[model samples]
Target: MRARLKRLLPRTLFGRSVLIIVTPLIVLQAVALQIFYGTHWEVVSRRLAAAVAGDIAMIVEMLARHPGEETLAWVTREAFARLELVIRLEPGAVLPEEPDPRTGPAEAELAAALAERVRLPFRIAWPRTERAVEIAVQLPDGLLHVEAPAKRLFTGTVTVFVIWLIGSALILFAVAVLFMNNQVKPIRRLAAAAEAFGKGQDVAPIKPEGAEEVRLAAASFNRMRERIARFLAQRTEMLAGVSHDLRTPITRMRLGLAMLTPRLGEEDRAEAAALERDLAEMEAMIEAYLAFARGEGAEQAQPADLAELIEEVARKARRNGAVVTVEAEPSLVVPLRVDAMRRCLTNLVDNARRHAAHVWLGAARSVRPSGGAAVQITVDDDGPGIPPEQREHAFRPFVRLGATAGAGGTGLGLSIARDIVRAHGGEIALEESPRGGLRARISLPA
Candidate 1:
């Protein structure tokens, strides 16, 4: 039980706020109930019963005044109906204890009160009992006693307190609920904004509103995000510049190799050619680094024909002896940086061409789990396909398969393709193609 309560305790500020605001209110209400009953309940009930005691006192006095048993009986009966008093000790003494049916014994509180030198508890009974039997009390040596009946058990005091307790409890509970909701709102908003930010989507930072500490926390988080963004931007700029500069040296060296080939022997020329292959790989890596830094080819996003782009890449590859086909329909003029989209398509097409003689480019609309649809552009190839386990690894930089060190290009092709697609809020994945070769799929929102 303790462990369950501990688990229910708040692990967050929002939950703590709700607990803080409501817990004390409930406790205070409970305490107030105890005090209300202790302080005024009996006093009120006794006040309602006082009228009967007066009537009984009058009856005893009338008997002393005149020798008339009928008058005495009439006064006693009237007193019994109004005041639920059965046995009331006169001033200065206590009343006797009576049996309680619920406990199979006398109530200890009742016994204790009666035993007190100052308290006198009267037994209140029903009106019908008065008509059945005449009650007589035995007075003590130093105290007076009177007997009465039970018709007046329910007094106005009991009704008033009952109504008050119920109403107060209900009002307190409603106030607690409202307080809990108000306390939890700010934190709930922060959680939603943080989740959207984690997914790398645009989200407005939560406004720093509410309690003082909550506002400070939100302000800190917003500041931290800004710092990290600036750092990433600077880092990207550096990588792009360095990568872009290295390409010039690599280009000049490749041209130098052409000049050297004319003067060297066939064996030496072939060895130099090997070095050229390594240089090309370095060039590709540098290009990928730079492209990642530039972000979406540094092109402004605009509506474009994805099918036409795929067909254009395929046609270029076909001119270079690649068997690639396109199977796509005219659809959305989507928002995309043209240069980045072109680069992604070029990489996928080139990679496909290297693996197979035939590559099929197709488009389809797929439903998302979120009740939305995505525009899917697929590349299918017919060659030795990538293993299922390695499909996910294919998009990593410098990761190559079914091809070697000197395979004529940097492995950055697919990596750059993925980056570009992601920048447009899309995705790329490798899977088995019907043609048995590596299939690269790019999905975007339509």
Candidate 2:
């Protein structure tokens, strides 16, 4: 039940906040309406009905005491002119056999009011006409018929009350929405900044604002970002220095080996050549380590054609005598660090070229489950693919598959590619391709 409720809830903080504020407001308004209609409105209707019934009793009493044609005419004329009531005298008239079932409060109130004030055999008719009520009180010689306007007994206080209640609720809701939006804006900015940082994009420092908790969160995020940046900077500098120091020794050894090669005997020259190969492999390893540790070098994100980038990588691989097939949409642009993304694709393509005779590179636009746009690039090869269990191990730096360990690589290609892809808020997955080899799938948000 808890999980189901969570699924039904609004996803964003802003939407949930508004729901929290408005839910109670709606419940309160409903309660207020119930009270007004059930109690206040009924009370007001009863009071008005009683007042009108009293007026009718007084008119009937005056007519009974006078009992003459001139007096009756004067009373009817005076009632019409002053009280806004129509009174008439009907001679030799009978009452109805049955009366309406007194259901509503207004009808009940009028019936009780008439019984208390008048002592005659009277029948009341509440018809659907201009006049609200018709009271026919029987007299000895005739009958007294009185018609009163609907407004007299039923004042529109309930309608006015409802309007005032709804209007005030609407005003309060508008104010709540405005306040909630202002409160949520700072939190949204904090989230955006954090996401960008996680994706290795350079974002400006967030200025703490809004509520105290939001301000505290922003401050904490800034501190964490600074610490991570400092750590990366220190690590990159250390690796760069190591690479620089090692390169000097390797270069000196290479030159010395070349100088001794021309003067040495066949056995000595063979030994020197093997030593040169070792030195060259060491140089390649150092270069790979430096490249992996550089962290793409503070390159800002810019819109670039992803399809073109893929095609270029494939073209380069093709030039190196690899059979490369490219299938990519034209002009699929996305915000990314061009150099970093290009390097990542080149690494994947290069790795494929090393083990496979036929390489397939594919790029296309895709949609994520969250209704956002994404770009997917796939590199597949028809070589002897790594075992499913070992595919994950291949992504670890310096950890190569046993089958491909002797294939002349420093084993940092997949690791470096994964690092760059992940830095751009993307993922790299290895799976069995349709081509009977491994597939490197890269998915990046646009």
Candidate 3:
């Protein structure tokens, strides 16, 4: 049953909003109407009956002015035509008895209203009909019994109440929709804030300006973001300082080795050459750290064809004797931080080249099954593939396996590439390539 209701719900925000607002209003108004009928219906009917009794009193007061009983009855019927009013008097009490059953439905309704009261509009019911001879039976203390038809009076009162209920529900529904929209605004703002944070973009603190819970959520999110930003800043500063200092000492060592190049023995020269190789590797590691540690770049997003970017990266790899091929369709533009995305794609292609003899780059625009345009770019290589367990593990910074450690990588390449792609609202994954090697699949917005 819950599943059925979920399926029936409107898929769009506006439709859901309208349904949420209107459904509760209709139910509440219906409940209120039932309550009103249960508690106050008798009171309203009694007040109406009392007014009818007053009119009947006036009729009795002016009865002497009439020429006869027949004329007086005619006058009474005409006066109470629209309302279910009854008039029957008992000996100088100056009020009507309850309506006679022989009369109409209106009279019976008026008579029923006085059923509980004594010495007022007297008791009335439909014990018998068809005998138009209206009876004025005597009760204790000069009370008179009266009866009339009940069906018409019941119908008339119900009609009026139903009209009132419908109008009240409509007015209430309008007010509810307005308030619901206002209440939902903060939720929408919170969602947008989360999306911005996901993209590594700066989201301004949303003042929880709605209900107490919404305000609390916004405050919590803002506080968490501030703490994360501070942490990232301090960590990046420390790494940058260490890398810079290490590079200075290494530069001095490289110069000292150069100064001894002429006097060094064959084995000593070989050791010095190996030391130079170590220095170069350290330099590369520092460069990788600098690139990977950077956060969201303050570049304006612009539409660019991801296929074109992949092709350019592959072309650069080809010039360096790497057999990289690109296959893609053109004119598929998506919003991107161009510089960061370029670095990310270049690193992935470069990694492929270092791993495999043949690199193939392919791009295609695909849509997610749940609905969203996704651009898929793949870099496949024909090298020994990583195990399934290690595929995801290798994407982390500074994690190197047995074979990859000697491959001249800082191990930050894949991690930095994944980070940059995620910042653009995209993802990267590793899978078995057709070449029996690793295939890197990157998905971005289209």
Candidate 4:
């Protein structure tokens, strides 16, 4: 029940805020209308009905006391001029056996007032005229036919009250929506800036605005963004210095070893060759280390064709003596740091090529778990797949699984691929491939 209610709720702060403002307003107005109709409106209607009925009763009594042609003519003129009533005497007419039932509050109130004051058998017809009610009262010598204006028993206040309620509610709702949109704009801007920054896109600092709490949050976000930028800059510079310092000595050592190889004894020549191989391996490891430590380093995300990138990675793997095939949807475009994404795909492809005889790459449009549009990239190999339990462990830096232990690698391939993918606000996971090996799947938001 709680979950169902949550699903029905507004998904954004602006919508929820309007609901909060409008709900109580509606309820309060409804209560006010109830009280008005139950007391003040009803009382005014009853009083109006009583006054009209009392005037008609007085005319009936006067006619009964003085029954003559001259008196009748005088009473008709007085009733028309003073009471706004049209009256006539039918010499021997009879009342209807059954009168029509009262259907409205005004009709019901008028009928009750006549019953209490007139004290005579009569029938009322609302259809006698468009703007009047016909009342016929039975008398000893004749029937008294009276046509009373409908306004006598009904008040204009009810219509005016209803119009006021509706007009005021609409005006209030419109004002609340406009005010809330202004209040929510700054928060929306903050959220967008944070998402862009996470995807490695450059974002300018946003100005603080709106209420005090929103302004404070925006200010804090700007400060945090600056701190992170400063830290990344410092780390990138240190990594560059380390790469240069380490490579210069390794190059010199390789040159010196080449010079000494020819002068060594036959057995010593084999030892020198072994030492050279170790040196080359150390250099490769250092390169991998620096590349991993440097991260994506100041690269900005821009629109790129993911399909083209996959084909490029496949082509490079083919040149490196690995059999590779690519099947990608054309123009599968998304924002990416081209070089960083290229390196990331290269690592996955290279790692696959070392152990498998065949590799396949694919890219296509997809959807993220949260229902957003996304692009999916897959790298598949026919080599022995990692155990399900060990796949996650393989993504830990320098932790090669037992299945991949015999595979010659720096053991940073999966780790580096994951880091790069995540920096682009994407996810990478390992799963069993239909090709009977491992599948490296990547999902990036479109």
Candidate 5:
């Protein structure tokens, strides 16, 4: 029951806020109306019915005392002129039958009053002329007919009360919606800023607005973003310094190895060459570390042709003697840091090309599970695929799978690719490719 109610409730803060405000108001109005109808309305209606009934009773008493044509004419004129009632007398006539049962409060009240005050058998015809009630009272001489306006027994207060209640509710609802919209706007801006920051986009601090608590949250988010930026900057600077310091000695050693190469014996030259290769590999590893630390590196996202970027990566792979095919539209664009995304795609393609003979790159528009537009890019290769269990392990830093461990490359390829994709508020997953090898799938918001 609780879960069902939760599902039925409004999902947004603004909608829920309106419900919280209006639900109680509707309930209050309902209760107030119930009270009015139960007590005040009924009392007023009974009093009005009793007054009309008393006038009829007085006329009947006068007719009983003075039974003459002249007196009957005077009574009829006075009733019409004073009470706005139409009266007539039927000589030697009897009532045909009783009217239908009274249903409404005013009809019931008027019937009860006539039974109490007039003490005569009567039939009341409601809405006799769309605005009157015809009452026929049985008499010894004839039937006394009285047609009174329906307004005499029914007060206009109920209509006025209902209109006032509905009008006030409508006005209050309009005000609540306007106020809630204003309060929610600042929160929406804060959320957008947070999402952009998480995606490593350059988002300015949001202005504090709306309620005090919301403003405080905006201020806190700004402070948190500043701290994170400072931390990343410090980490990047430290890694850069380490890369520079290590490269200086490595460069000097390479120069020294080149100088001694010609002077060495054949076997010694071969050993020196092996040493040079090892030195070069070390330098490559250091550069990879620096690249990983640099991350998005102060780059702001802008609308770039995603298809063109994929084609550029394919061209670079082809230049390196790898067979690459790109399947993408001509003008698919999305917001991304060009350099960072290029490096990410390059890493994925390079890893695939190193192990596979042919590489396939494709991009297309897609929809996320949360119903958002996204761009999907796939890097596929026709080589030995990683085990299902080990696919996730491949994304761990420096963790290489056994099948592709022989490929001469740092294990950070997949890790770096995953990092860059996630930094763009996208996702990267390893799946089976149609080409019978690994597929690196990246989904970014469009």
Candidate 6:
């Protein structure tokens, strides 16, 4: 039951805060109404009813004491003029067998008061037509009929109380909504800043505002961002230095091997050629390492035509003697780091070209189940696909499959591509393609 109620609740801080504030307020109002009607209003009605009944009883007693027709007529005329009551002396009238079904607190109080003050039997009628109460009291001579305004007995304080209570509740709710919205706004800005940072987009520093907790959170986020930036900078600089130091020696070794090759015997020449191949491989590995370390170099995100980017990648692959085809929506623009995205796609296409004769590149817009829009880029190839178990292994840096290790390249391509994609708040997955080979799918928020 608790879980179901949680599911039914609003899924935002502002909405839930409003619910938290308004629910208790409504309950308190309802309890207040109950107390008013059950205790306070009932007491007030009874007191009012008793006061009206007392007036009626006094007039009846005055009529009884007068006894003469002329004196009774004078008493009736004064009562009507002063008390706003209509009194009549009926000689042969009879009371009804049953009273009205809508008997209430005022009627009960009036009946109790009349019973105490008057000696004779009486009947009361609440006639709807005139909105008044009619009382028939039996005197020794005849029946004394009385009509009093119903409003005299019941003053409708309940209606006024309800109106005030509802008006106050609505005002309280409006104030609560305004305050909650203001409180949640800072949290929303904090979340957006974090999201943009995660996507490798530069965001302005967020000013600490709102409550102390919210300000503290914003401060912490800013500190974490600075720390991460510093760490990435230090790491990139260190790796760049290592790569630069190693490259000079490697180049000298290549030059030395070229200079000495012509003077070597046949066996020595073969050995020198093997050394040259190793040096070349070493150079390639160092370049790949540096490329991965640099992380595409502080590229700013801008709106770029993704379809054109894919077409350009395909065209480059084709120029390199690979069969490449592209299917993309034209003029499909998305916010991306153009150089980083281009490098990432080039790596995937190159990896595909090395292993497969035919490569298929495609891009299209997609919508997530959670109602977010995204763009999906697919690179499919007709090569020997990695096994399901080894697919994840392919994404790790410097790790190559024994079967495909002789393809003449360092195994950092997929790793670098994945790093770049993930930096943009996107994901890459490997699956079996329709061409019976590997399929690399990248999904990025549009």
Best by TM-score: 4
Which candidate leads the pack in lDDT?
5
Better of 3 and 5 by lDDT: 5
User: What CA RMSD would you report for each candidate?
Assistant: 10.7, 4.4, 10.5, 3.8, 3.9, 5.3
Clashes of 3: 9
**Clash-forming residue pairs, model 1:** 125-150, 126-150
Q: What TM-score, over all chains together, does every model reach?
A: 0.52, 0.83, 0.67, 0.84, 0.83, 0.77
26-89, model 3: which lDDT tens digit per residue? 7876887788766676556556555545554444445546646686577657655754445454
lDDT of 5 at 263: 99
Give lDDT per model, in order. Answer: 0.65, 0.87, 0.73, 0.90, 0.91, 0.88
TM-score of 5: 0.83
Which digits, one per residue and each the tens of the lDDT, describe model 4 over residues 159-234?
A: 8998898888899999999999999999999999998888777889989999999999999999999998999889
Q: What does candidate 2's lDDT look like per residue over 1-446, in tens digits?
A: 99999999999888898888888988988998899878887788888878877888888888879888999999999988988889999989877778655666777888888888876778777786556678788888888898888787787877787788889878878988899999999998998999899888877789999999999999999999899889988998798788778989889989999998999999999999999999989988888888888878589888999888888888888888989999888998998899998889988888888898899999898997677899898999999988999899899999878768888888999999999999888899999999999899999998
lDDT of 1 by residue, 1-446 (tens): 99998897987765676567667866876787678667676555454345444454455455547634575466556655665443323444444566422221112233233333223333322234353212233333223344433333234655676677678767866776677677567767777766545434455667898778778878887887688567767877787677658777888999999889889998999899898888876776676666655555335577887777777887888898988778987765666677778888888888777767788989877775555778888989887877888777877777776553345567778888888788777888888887777678788866
Candidate 3 weakest lDDT stretch, 10 residues? 131-140
Q: What's the best-to-worst order under lDDT?
A: 5, 4, 6, 2, 3, 1
Off by more than 4 A, model 3: 9-24, 28-166, 296-300
Candidate 5 residue spans exceeding 4 A from truth: 50-76, 86-150
Candidate 1 vs 3: which has more TM-score: 3
Which clashing pairs does model 4 show? none
Query: How many residue pairs collide in each prediction?
Result: 2, 0, 9, 0, 0, 0
**Candidate 4 wrong stretches, greater than 4 Å:** 52-80, 85-150, 265-271
The candidate 1 region of ten consecutive residues with least summed lDDT is: 100-109
